[model samples]
Target: MKDAAKASGSKEQTADTTGDEGEAPAAKPKKRKDNKGKDAPHYSVKEPAGYYPILPVQVVPAAERPRVFAYASSTRRDFEVFNRYDLSQDLDFLILEIRQGSHSPFLLVLMYNQDAPDDTQQRGRSFERFKALALPDMPIVIAMDANEHHPLWEREKL
Candidate 1:
């Protein structure tokens, strides 16, 4: 019975010592304080040349053309008629090819009314229709005559 007690006591001591032997020492936790205005001086770095305002063409590919459709009222028929000329051939770059039952690549509705009533409403409806049917990324451009004057027809002052 005494031998058993001695063995048990020695076992307990062994267990306690062994348990602590492999454990690493506890490290002190680092405390972080907000420095705010107490931080070191910071320098304002200048951006490289032409970096402030990025050029649109630099970011946007030149070949990336958005589909556009141009609708013109009778008062603006001249614009549409002019579009048929060779000079107008390049206009396709500004418009997407319209596919039946498919949304236009992009929509360009031209308002050519001399004194058209509710023209803005019509424009809004057209925009909504395109938005509903067009691809999510498709772009829409609305080209309209300013007032009753045609800017393209004006002679250059220079």
Candidate 2:
């Protein structure tokens, strides 16, 4: 049985090498045509003034793929740490709240961190310990610093 396994392994290796040798070179993907000139067909699309429509985003359902509700404290220390460690992986949405007004909820985005490295391999690890804790899929709101940094205005010589 051991001899047969070794023979099969050798045959598989030889077959893989032969397959590689017989395979054609990969072709480059086709690029889309630039529609910058007047010859390009223009669809009749009108934009409403003062009221912009929210664009639809591709998001996997929570049932199929677990969704994360990530938010930083008012100091944004956690966010900075997460960003530095490149830990925002497998997160369907990244909700960033600009302000915590008297009656304002949070703004969200159904996207992953574009800047993180090895994100594919580190899938769903972004949730970390939070994964164990059960949470609802409701809107997560995080109040942020309205003006964290401001230039001090002092009377000085120009």
Candidate 3:
């Protein structure tokens, strides 16, 4: 697992968030500015203490494999993991919420769908459950890898 960690660019270091005694006022989330073609700093993660390893992640299909795992960063003490939704084992999808600052919390859904005809029913049921779980008038972001070839998306070929 350690070897896999290194191979996958997982670090064993902790983030630095030390400061003075009194807590400073929390800054508003800033929109990232254009770098004018320059490379931006890569987002990195540090495995916190007592990190657990889950094997057989590759056992699932590549498109429907588990991707998102919520972890805490010592620096971002304002962020909180609220809820987790497990829809199905066959369909690889995860739904969770993370709240930051005084703003309304939003749902983050990580999904991957296979564009096969046989998977249509399972996908339909999963989406139905997803809709049922969502709260009205709340923000939701679905980050997905879909293998759909459609003219609407300008994908004329599969």
Which numbered prediction scores highest in TM-score against the true structure?
3
lDDT of 3 at 117: 41
User: Model 3: how large is the Cα RMSD against the reference?
Assistant: 16.0
Q: Which candidate leads in lDDT?
A: 3
Candidate 3 residue lDDT tens string, 104-137:
9886666654432474454353345455553546
The count of residue-pair clashes in candidate 3 stands at 0
lDDT (10s digit) by residue, model 1, range 1-158: 01122333432111001123243322224322223532111111233443221111111212222132233233322222112111111211222222223444443434322321262332333333333443335455656443455667688832
Candidate 1 colliding pairs: 68-95, 68-96, 69-108, 71-110
Error of 3 at 6 (Å): 32
How badly does each model clash, as a count of residue pairs? 4, 0, 0
Q: Which 10 successive residues of model 1 have the least lDDT summed?
A: 53-62
- What's the distance in Å from true for residue 149, model 3? 3.3
Q: TM-score for all predictions? A: 0.18, 0.23, 0.41
- Candidate 1, 24: how far from true, in Å? 97
TM-score order of candidates, top first:
3, 2, 1
- Quick one: how many clashes does candidate 2 have? 0
Model 2 Cα lDDT, one tens digit per residue, 30-138: 3223245222111112234432212111122111222333333333322221121111224334333333434444333334322223524443333332243343354
